[model samples]
Target: MTGHLHPLHEALERLDEAWGDADDAGQLSRRQLIAVTEALGLLHRRSGAMLAEVAACVAHESRTELGAASLAKEQGFRNAAQLIATTTGATAGDASRLVKVGEATAPRRNLLGEATPPKYPAAQQALAAGRLSAPAVAAIIALLDRVRLTLGATETAEAERLLVERAQGLSLDDVRRLVTRAEAWLDPDGVAPREQEQRDRTSLSIFERDGRIHLDGDFDAARGAPIVAAVNGYVSALFAAQKEQIDPEAPDAARRSVAALRAEALSVLCAHALGCEDEAPALAGASVVVRIDVSDLADGTGYATIDGSDLPISVSTARRLAAGGGVIPCVLGTDREILDYGRERRFFTRAQRLALAERDGGCAMCGLPPSMTRAHHIRWWKRDAGPTDLENGVLLCESCHHRIHDNDWEIRIEGTGRQSRVWFIPPPHVDPDRTPRLGGRARYDVVA
Candidate 1:
C-alpha cells in the first residue's frame, strides 16, 4: 500500500506544480480552470487526510506508554493541539484533526509544513486591543477556512495574506455586521432602491358643492396645523352659537345640525332689522328695489336722488344708511337727540348695498373677489323676513348665490361678540363629513 500511494502522491505533486506555473503566467482564465483545479484540489485533500490518519495512529501509541512505542512525545502533538486550539478558538475535535494532519504532513516533503499559515494572529490581537471585535475576527477566519477548502495550497496562502492586510483597522464585530447587511441585499424579495427613494419624497384642496363644502387635501404633520385650526374655528363658532339657542335637552343631531343653527341665526338678524321680534314684518305697503351706483349719498348731493331730493350724507354714513333701509326718515335733531318727522319711502338703498359689500365682501359661500360676488339675503325680502342689515345680508359670488337660492341651500350669520360669524350650508354630497358643512373663512383682509 505504501509503495502504490508514493507514486500517486508524487504524480499529484507534479500536477500541482504545473497548475501553479499556469496561474502565475496568467494563462489560465479563472472561470475555465476553476472546475478542473477544484477536482484536483479535492484529491489532494484526500491525500492529506490519509497522512492525518497515520499521524493519529502514531500519536495514540505515544500516549499509551505501556503499549506500542509512543510517537506523541517524538512529534510534540499535544503541544501543537493546545496551541492551535488556543490561537484559533477551534473546537477540541477540530483542533485534534488539524494537529493530526500537521503531524502526518510534516514528515512528507510538503509545503503545508512551511506555509506560514494565517492563524489570524493580527485579527486576534486587534480584538484583544479593542480595535477589532470578535465577530469581525470570526468573519476573517471563516473566509480563510473556505479558501483553504476550495483553493490550491498556494492560492489559499495568498488569500490569507491579502485578508490580514485589509483587516488592520476594522473591528471584528463591525466587519461582521457590515457583511450581514450586504448579504441581505442578495435577497430577491428585498425592497427596491427606487421604492425607498420615492418614500422619502412623499402635499395638502379647500372647494364647495350642492349646499356642502369639502376640504380634502394631504399635508405633512408639520403643515397640517393651520388647516385644522381653520376648520376647528368654524366648527367651534357654529357649535357655540347653537348651544345658546337650543335647550340642553335638544337632540344632539338637531343642536349640532349646521343647517338648523344657521336658519335660526338668520331669522334673529332679520327680526332685529325689521324692528320686529322673532320674525320679519310683511312689506304690504313698502316698495322694493335693488340697484348699485357709485355716488356720495351721505353728502346730500350725488348722481342719484333720494325722495326726489338731492341730499348727500358722508360716503361711510350714506353707505350705512342705504344698507339700513332704502328711505331715510327726516329727523330734526343733533347727533345725540332726534325728533322723527315721518316714514317717507321704503326701498333697498345704495347705502345698504354698499354696507353689504363692505361687510360681506364677496361670496359668503365662497370667498370670491368682490367684483365677481353679489349680495344675498338670508331671508327673501318678499317673504317679509329679510332685512337690508349687514347681519341679514351675505355676499356670495354669482355662481354660489345661484346655487344657494336656485338650489335651495341656506346661509346665515352665527355667533355673538368675538365669535360672531357668517357661513353657508351646502346641500348633501358636497361634504359627507358634516351636514351643511360650514363655509371657510371669509377672504376679505381684516384691516388692523
Candidate 2:
C-alpha cells in the first residue's frame, strides 16, 4: 500500500526469517541460541509498538461519542480492549496496557488542528525505536502522569526523559524501581498523603478454608515493612538449611516449599510475640532494618529503603520506624567482635548471637536467621565438654539441630571470628567419603 511494508508486517517477516524452525533450536550452538533470542525479542518489541498504535486507534474509533454505531459495537465487542484481546488472544489486562501506552505516546492534535508533541516524547521515541516494551512504557507513563500535576512542567519533562532513559536495557521490575524512586523525587510532598492512603486501605482477613486456616491481608509500606523483613529473613534461613539436606528423599528431610516455609515463619513470629508479652521475657531482636542517607535523615527529605523491598518509603516513615527501634540506627561495622565465654554460660548472650549472625549470616548448618536459631556447641556442652566460646558455638535451627544429632552429621568451624566459615560433614550413608560441604554465608555466594 506504500513505499515500504507496514511495520507490523515487516516485523512478522523478520521474525519468521530469523526464527526459522523451532525444532532446530536444540541443534544450535549456545552462541547462536542467544543471538536468536535477542533477534526475536527485538522483532517482538517492534510488533508490540505497532500493535499499541493500532489498539489506540481502535479505542478512538470505539469512543462512546459514536453511540450505538461505535466500532466495537459493530465488531460485537463491549469495548476496544475486549476487541483487541479477542482478536489477538491476549489478556484483557495486557490489551489495556497497550492502549494506555499508545495513547500516552501517540502524537496529538489540538482542537484547532495544530500538531503538538505527545504526553511523553522520550517514552514515545523509545517505544518507536523498539528499546522499551509496552509494559515498561505503560509503567513509566503511569508514574509520570500521576505526579505531573504536582511537578512543574520542566521537572515533569525531565523526569520523563530520565525514566525512559533508565528503563531501557532494564527488566520491567527494574523499571518499577526507577519509577518508585522517581515518584518520591518528583512529588516529595505527596509521599505522606499516599502513605496515609495505603494505611487507610490496610486490612486482614482470616477464615477456615477446607481443612486449614487461610489468611489474606494487605499492608502499607510503613506498617508492613517490618513484617515483610521478618518473614523473608526467616524464609531465607529455612532455604539455607534446606540447601544442606544430604537426603531430600529421607523420611524427615526439610522439604517444604517456600509458601509452606512462609506460613511456618508467620506462626513462629506470632508465637514469639506472645512469648514477649510475659514478664521477664527474653530480649527481642530487631525485626526490620531501614536504610536512609545521612543527609536525608537530617534534612527530612527524600526516601528510605527497607530491607527485602525495592519500594521507597517517605523519610517521615523511616524516622517513625527508627524511633520505634525497628530500624538499626547505626552500622556495627568491625568494632563489634565475637564474645567468648568458655563454659561460663549455658546460653549464648545477645551480644554473642549478634556476632554469630555476622559470621554465619544465620544458622551455621542452615541459613535460618539468628532469632529462630539456638547457639549450640560444635562440640556439645554436655556430651563433648564443649566450651560456650564463639569459636565452639554454632547456630542451628530446630530441624537442623535434630538432624545433626539424629543423623551423626558434624559441624566444623574453620578460621576465627568473622573470617570463620561453617562446614557440614555428611554421614557415611549420605556420602561415603564423608566430604565436608561449605555452609554459612559462603553458601549464598553468587558463583560465576
Candidate 3:
C-alpha cells in the first residue's frame, strides 16, 4: 500500500524542508526572510490543528486505559467516554483525565499490547523549561474539558487555534507563572478554589453590604470572642455587687430590674466616655457606683431620686435592686425619703468596666468586639418575672441579640447563688434535636 499526500500537506512539508535548509545554512536574503516568515505563520496555523488532533487522540486513548484498569480491578467498565475531573489541590481529577488520554493514544502492538506513546513536544518543552508547574498542566487539561463540552468538532478546532495562537512564544513555565500570579491577584482572600466550588454548589451567598454592616456575611466567631467576654465580665461584676445589697429571698423580677439598670448604666457610662472626648477625662477619675433600691418599698410610681435629682427608674432597674444589690440608705425620719446617704459608689466604675472588657474580651456567641456588642438582658423585665441580676444579663453581639429576642428565641439562666449561668437556644436549623446550649464560665472570677 502507498500513502498519498494532500495538496495542503505537500505544501506544508515543502515549506518545512526549506526552513530546515535555511537554518542549516545560517544565511538568508531580505526577500528569502520575508518568504520564510510568511511560511512560518502558515505553519503555526497548521501546527495548531496538529496539536488539537493529538489532544483528541490522547483523550480517546485515556478512556480505553481507564476501562481496562477498571475491568482488571473487577470494576464495571462502561463505554469508553472522555471526561476530566480533578482530585488533588484543586485539579486532581484533571491530572487523572490527562494521564488517561496519554495512555489511550499509546501505540498498539498486537504482540506487545501497547508501545511507547509520542511525546507532546510543546508541552514537554514547556515543562522541561520550568515554565509550567504540575498544577498549571492540570489546569490546561481542565480547560480542554471545558472546551470539549462547549464546542463541537469544528468549534473545538477553532478554540484550539485560539489557544495555540495565544500561547505563541511562551514556554510552559511562563504560562504557569502567569496563571499563578493571575489567580492570586484575583482571589487574595485565600479561599481555595475547590472550597469555593463547594460553596457555590451549596448556594451559600456570602456578600458584602453597603450600609449597616451585616454580621452574618462574615461568619467568623473566633475573631469576636474577646469582645463578648468583656461585656459579660462587666455585667457579672455589677450583678455581684447588687446581690450584696438585696435580701437573699427577694423576688426574681426586682433583682432582674436592678441588674438591668446597673448593666445599662455601666453601658451608658462606658459609651459616654468612649463616645465623647470630655467624658473620657471624667472616666479616668470616676469611681464605681453601686446603688440599691427596694422596689416594693418605693412608691408605685417606680421613680427614685439619685444625687438629689429625681430620676425616673424603670421597673427593670427597680426590680434588679429589690432582688439583689440593694444598698439601703439610713432614713433620717419616718418618711420614705432618704436622710443620710451611704458611700456613693458606682456599680460599673470606669476601672471596673475596662477591666471587665479586658477580661471577658468580646461577645461569647460570635466573638465580636465589645464595642460591637450590646449588653442584653437574658430575661426581659417587661415580662415581670425577669431579674436584672448579673446572672440574667449577657453580652451578645447586636446580631445575636436580635436573633435571640427579636426572633422569638429564648435565653436561659442556670447555676445557683452568686455565680449564675446563661445558655442560648439556637434556632431550629442550628441543631434541631439538641436543646439550647450554654457557654461561658459559671463564676465571675476575674483572672487578673
Best by lDDT: 2
Q: Give the alpha carbon lDDT tens digit for every residue of 187-238 in model 2.
A: 7677777778888999999999789998999998767777766776666555
Backbone clashes, each candidate? 29, 4, 61
Stretches > 4 Å off in candidate 2: 1-22, 242-254, 276-287, 330-448
How do the predictions measure up, each by TM-score?
A: 0.22, 0.68, 0.24
Model 2, residue 138: C-alpha shift (Å): 0.6
Per-residue lDDT over 169-258 for candidate 1, one digit per residue giving the tens place of the 0 to 100 score: 433433443333222222212222322343344332547889876656554222232223233323334443344754455345333565
C-alpha lDDT of residue 73 in model 2: 92
What digit string (tens of lDDT, one per residue) describes model 3 on residues 1-448?
A: 2222242365476567656656543487554565666565555444433333344454555444565654312333232222222112224344344454343223445556665533333443332333333334444444444445445556544443334333444445434433332332222233233224433443224356885323332211211222233344444434444446543553342346634644554565567657785533111122212122344235432222111111123333334444443122211122222111112321333333322233233354544444444444565655644544444456565567667666566666564322334556765644465486544322111111
True lDDT of residue 12, candidate 3: 73
By lDDT rank, best first, the candidates go: 2, 1, 3
Task: Name model 3 segments beyond 4 Å from true.
Answer: 1-87, 90-361, 416-421, 427-430, 441-448
